[model samples]
Target: MPARARLCATVPALLPSSEADLPEVFGLPGRRLLAQRGDSALVVQALDDALVPSGGSVRVPAPWPRRRGTWAVAPDASLAVFAGVHAVRAVEPSGATRWEVRHGCWYGACRELHESYEEYADSKDHRYPEGGSAGFSVDGTFVWAHVRGPLAAGELGPDVVDEWLLLDATDGRVLGRADAGAAAAGSFHLPHPSDPRQMGLSIGEGQDGAPLRWGRWDGRTLAVEYVEGDLTLMSVSPSGERLMTVTHDQDALAVRDTGGSVLEGLEWAAGTAVPRHPDAEPDNDEALPYWDWAGGFVDETTLVGSTVEGDEEWGEGRHWIIDTSGARTPVEVTYPVTVGPQPPTALGDGTWITPAKSGEALYVWALD
Candidate 1:
């Protein structure tokens, strides 16, 4: 049976002040406008519905000196902002420091894990000068960071090797380290949603090893599990029973059992191209490619995605609601590209919230 959708509410026309990119909208229910102003990198939280700050805004102090990488919010609504070269800083809800670590990789030639609680109230906590990046667990109890191989500045090519370190959240302690040696490409990290202790590290083409590797941490021992295919993105279902992933080679979205068995595959519809604007010039490449299935289960068998067609001038991206019950045509939600991220909290409400790309604005949509 197809799940019914409702038109809840639309909070449209909330605009930002500057050119914003990388908008992360969290569904805090009553919480509105938790976004970053691109120009200032100011993490603002709006308390009231009136988008403009009549209610006032709080500025998140930058964790690192450099502006790169992304930020993640914990279930408790605390913020973890990543400064590429600087360590990951954990900010409390009351705007105080919970903890901070100065992280580094071997290739980067920096050493020392600087930990700070209330001590360095002024200075940021620093980690070892290795090339590894950090990821927080779902509960924010752990951080899994990967560091690349040793090399002087500009000397390390794409193929440089690296290591993965699992750290303790209470205090910045290296719980375990794994040898992730020489690879031909850049690596991306995906922490497993089901098992907070494990993470998937993907080393793209540059590496000489398998394209996909899943690392599992069992308290005292850490293990690396391999998967077949060029994995693009890996996310666990809200229920944590299934694994959802997209591959680089094909547009098909695959779902696997949490134990690593293939459950089903949904191929992108071929003729269903991105709709082009009426006044746009005709071109073969106009159909924007549908890539990156940022999917989460709508039900046990249904998944929803915010997809963009390859064509540059076509439609604002389209929403694909895929049904995996058997074989079926996925239902789609087509709207203006201005629609921010797809519904942040999928509680079967049929309504999703997307923050504007600039992080200045937010849009709420209810499926028709």
Candidate 2:
């Protein structure tokens, strides 16, 4: 049976202050929207219960181009941090650099401590260099960053290629550090909702493996626990007790406890949970559905997911709502209008956001 999804709001993408590029919208844990444009500026806006913008968007200057690396804004939207190829810089809205910490180069073989982006900005080797990411804690006091190893001279070790550092968000002071023990092509951070001391790190090593790490700071020391090797951490539940993850192969989705114990898991079987594509030939063995890499908890007991990638070859992608504590069955979600093939992103509220076909707006959906 199909469940009806209600249309909450059709929020237009934020107009960019920069020239030429379309703005991108990111849905944060809180009911907030961070619309970023080019590498020139960022606009943070809040959403009301109806999923509409609540007030004026706070625009801040981006420290570098968008293609450089990933970044995060503080919870209060007062500051923005850029995790660049050679340094992690904090920038204020007035385009002032509050502080910066230079680290080992993201380029695999380079060892020079670069003082500026211009040195290798045009180099062919640095064009596609692997990089790290940063995010601010919920309280906006601490910043958790995953970067290439060896913060300063003589700190390098044979096995330490990547390090996760905890920094003071205000002064950019390094408080604690831990060796991530992985050669990452890229990485990201997930902040704990209530506790500013704990955060999650997910690292991707291309076709090699996916590693999940959980970190905690005790105000004196930093401790990181290896969670799992083959799973990509998706969403943390509302109560902060459960986690949602999809297998690296996208074959299974599992609900696990905070300590990394699987509570419930479901796999895609054509005729059982996910239906066979109607456009596929009756005898075609190539038509199989796999889960998308995104999606999160709609609530503690239920979640919204999709088989968009697997469904793309046949036609429009499909979405679903899964019950975590019940029979673990998935019910297809039907929308009033057509949505793009991109995966649906759950807002951690009661709704989720999907991009418009034209890429100029976002539509928020909720179970009716």
Candidate 3:
């Protein structure tokens, strides 16, 4: 029998512009932050235990347009780091510049550290430059960043095009760096849940492939271990022991140890593990379901995932609660209300979230 999910809470989306552009809810160790973006600033607000917005929000002046890159808010919501085209800039809530680290331009052919976003803000070539990302360590004491290389004034050859940096989050000092060895189209940081010293980087090379890199910073040196290409690091388990990942083609999902060895995995096979949608046209060829490139652990031994993208045309999306402790198969999840096409996002607190039909709120669910 399919497991059931109960509605636990509904949190409104933070919209800085239109309703469709809701800000993302960033997951911190035990807290969550809604990082909303605006024309020239970002609003960082804390989420209460129930996932509702709580307390005052911090507005940090953005160094460039929100589309130029991504930003990470400090654990305390006091600082915001912008990983932009030409630099990684740290800004405070009071509109003050804390520090900046200029790096090689993300624009493939541009080599100048132009000093300001306005320099190439209107240039056609800079319109869609590839970008990098940053995130704070679990304790907020360090910032792990992925950037196009040849870091400002650093001793490195042109061949070193991309680098993962460990910086002192408080002062923006470069503590250590490691070559990413990727022609990244983009990337993001996944901070470990318990260990401030460890973090993950997932680099997307568009259709080429995705590369996952795990980094460990021990105060003096930064060591990186490369996982196989084409895997996107999704989330770390609550205990910081296991990781969840999906293949680039979305055909497989896996649970891995910190060392990058797969401990358990599941794949989709037509009319078997994932049968054809009942609502599919009777005469239609059998459709194979692929896992969504999203989802995470609800706890140490269980997870919530979806075949939403693969099921969309056939009917309403399908979600599941998979046992990672041993069974290693997906049991469908029955929701109390209609869930959207977006995959379920596990909160690591025995609950998960799905966008409501209204597009302005999220419905949190727990096992019924």
Candidate 4:
């Protein structure tokens, strides 16, 4: 049977200062939400009784002027890294600087990390933007960082290559490094929940979404794993038993073992049954469906899928719970209330977060 969803709690979301892009959700182990938008962010957490800092706590500032790159909070929520165009700077929760690594500019034309956002954006060599990202290990011992290959002037040279490094969080020492030989238009870091030495890097290839690079650091060596085609890694199961992703072009959702073998899969293009809905289309509701680029496995046995926009039947993009464990088929999750537009951020513990920034709150929905 399909699972029933309940609005268990409501919390504030980190809204951008002005008219800006939607915030990105970073799960901070203790049911916290790091809704980061551009250069600054707010960390709102789910507490035992209610979501934390109802008014939004201190702002996590970016090293640069505007939010041109990505940022991540350490596991303890004590430190944050600003992976700006020129360098990666780690700062404490109180805004005190810990360490900074000056590197090459991801934007080729830029000579250095400018304090002015316009100077870097307008003077960039490539039309597409370039930036870096960093994340702390699950145990907080190491920091996995990605940046445009370092240069003396912070600008890309004749032959620039992207670099990924494993750093010692305590001293900013490079533990391991690899050169990503792609001219990536953009990139971000997807953290592994269980392992401290492993993480995933997704690099954008312009019109072709992005390709993922799986990295593992075993004290001495850093292994960069790639399948050479479209296997954009999305959600790494909570137990680390498998990885789930919607294939290139959002054609199919494929689950793979850690060793890189397909276990079970589902393609949305194949006509899916319209779960009985009161507001479904009049007739011929069954049609080709597309999976959201962001949904994930609700648990070991269930996969929660979503779409950018829902049809007349599912309302504004339906959230489907599929029994990928093979014992049963997919079920359309029934929500007790109206859900918002952005894809659901699966917490992997029978709970997920739906951020309705426009509504100025986050809906923490639990499955029953």
Candidate 5:
């Protein structure tokens, strides 16, 4: 089994401190503040204005006993927390709290929000025996979740059945639920660029012969749209105007307009390959595709990604700048550290923030 790594807790200097009783601190994009008092994590924001903790501190209740998961920050600066057995709560900027109407089901699942950072829950009737995963809409208003289903009387091989669910982020209401039948493994939620109420679902095999399924959700309804290859990496553009997905054998990044129509398709260079990092374990199935780690869009035209070449550790990881103009090239940026997870996110001003795992430190790299 792959060793588990805990997320670093130390807050970087760029991130406001939780120690002082101060109201707020100015950081990169806005004024940020954090408070941890009486079993709650409070996040406050003041952007392009005077910093004040009095107006925006969101107090999140503590997790239930025996289970724990990570917390996610929404695009609008809200807090989405999964408290094991308790509930998933969305603490809004106005300090309003809304609990998942359906609780006690998503006990130990990977929960995340759309851009709005509202709360959502995956399918609970069918649970993944070992690990759980989920995805959200771009606006944070909707979610699509998958859970492993029960086995047959004399089943063989890994659990072959699974379930898919569409949820309303506003109230934890189950909008639609479906049993994906056998050979179904995982599902991802991709938001539409122009429509906040619509999202796309990508379901596929986990490791072996699991079938890949694709569908669309229009808030009030769910429908299977396409069933194709085994999808590996899936991402939607920041503007919610485009969707990009990659399969195992071939890679094609398709651009879809707001109407769910394919506008253009870019095929990855046939000979290019993702390289394996030295620290990755030999049996790690998740490590196969290097492009899986490469995501984030600087704009509608400029997309940033990481590329790996071979099993042998050779050159430093390459950053590729891709665009609709059809030219792909590596941009030069110095990576401060050579070890650990190297996930990078591009900031607004031609710069990127890569957080270090060991400490409360983040390296700001300016792209020249």
Candidate 6:
């Protein structure tokens, strides 16, 4: 049996503090972070893999005005890009514009592209469109961007059939692209930590089997090898050989190969069958457990799991360490400090990170 480690909370000394209020802290790959205050997003980097923040902060002109848009940073942490209403825009550290790509917008009645951010933000539709899931690749060489297609049928027409594009990180030029042949309600990117040319795009259709598109970019052509159905990919293994996903309804956590074959499946009901707390569901009612929507690999075999379900014993949520190397077994772990109630994101490394609601700092944990 594996025992849980009680990790202590430590704030990155380099993280900038807003005098008025704590700014929003967002974790990026390569142990970097962003502190957002209204229209400005301050990009900060970690001094070392320990995730200790460094000195300089770059101010980025946030897209979407409010918190309506999500941003991604390039490899060297020089360029920052945000998903716009009908396009993706890359900006400099000084909040200057670099380039923008005009993709399709979501207004069904109006197929025209959005000229300004205000017009697109005003629409009450999917603020983040079915095709608005955009982010840069692992190596920061290309950006895998999702754009809405023309309106179709059966599932809202071509709009459901989104476009996945690979754009040059420097000029925002389309290098390779493909049509995601599914009704994507939501989507995300999973970049292979080791392989820069490979990545994964997951599209959620709000059911038991969302489509997972595995893409291979071989310099010239950017193509999807196959579409794996029925799983919401959370993160790829550090080795890039295996990828992890949550069951359609959060009933289980599964690991699969690059071919989309289920290598291991850890059912929540089976793992949480024995309740550690009195507030846990009764033995008979343990048919379902609310698994955190997002989690990441600590190394190649260990995973940090979180859940919003809790009782008087647990504050807002609970964290668990599940060994995915073999024979799935879950051990509950507790944080030394409070970081509010929200799903924690895996930082590709061995860190489990969550944002503080106060927007000032991040809560991070490590397994010993």
- Give all TM-scores, in the order shown: 0.65, 0.92, 0.93, 0.82, 0.57, 0.82
Q: Report the C-alpha lDDT of model 6 over 93-136, residue by residue, as the tens digit.
A: 77777878776664434576666777766666745454456766
- Cα TM-score of candidate 5: 0.57
Give the top-scoring candidate (lDDT). 3
Predictions in order: lDDT: 0.50, 0.79, 0.83, 0.66, 0.43, 0.64
lDDT string, candidate 5, 153-174, tens digits = 1222243345555666667566
Consecutive 10-residue window with the lowest summed lDDT within model 6: 150-159
Candidate 6 Cα RMSD (Å): 4.5
Better of 1 and 5 by TM-score: 1
Q: Model 3, residue 69: what's the lDDT?
A: 92
- Model 1, residue 135: distance off in Å is 2.6
Tell me the deviation in Å of residue 97 in model 6: 2.1
Q: Model 2 over residues 1-368: C-alpha lDDT tens digits?
A: 78799998898777633352443344344456556555577667776656577888887787677788888888767888999998899988788899898888999989878889889989998888889999888788999999897776445476799999999999999998899878889988878877889888888888988888888999999998888657788887777777778777877777877677787454443345677667756677667677777788888788888888888899888888887777678888899988766788776677787877766678888899
Question: Better model by TM-score, 2 or 4?
Answer: 2
Which stretches in model 3 have alpha-carbon errors above 4 Å? 16-20, 28-30, 264-272, 281-286
lDDT of 2 at 80: 85
Q: How many clashing pairs in candidate 2? A: 0
Stretches of candidate 6 off by over 4 Å are 6-9, 12-42, 121-131, 150-160, 207-209, 264-277, 281-287, 309-316, 356-359
State in Å the error of residue 346, model 5.
4.9
**lDDT accuracy of residue 293 in candidate 4:** 72
Flag regions of model 2 displaced more than 4 Å: 16-31, 153-156, 264-272
Preferred candidate (TM-score higher): 2 or 3: 3
Give the range where candidate 2 is weakest over 10 consecutive residues by summed lDDT: 16-25
Clashing pairs in 6: 23-359, 152-157, 152-158, 153-157, 209-230
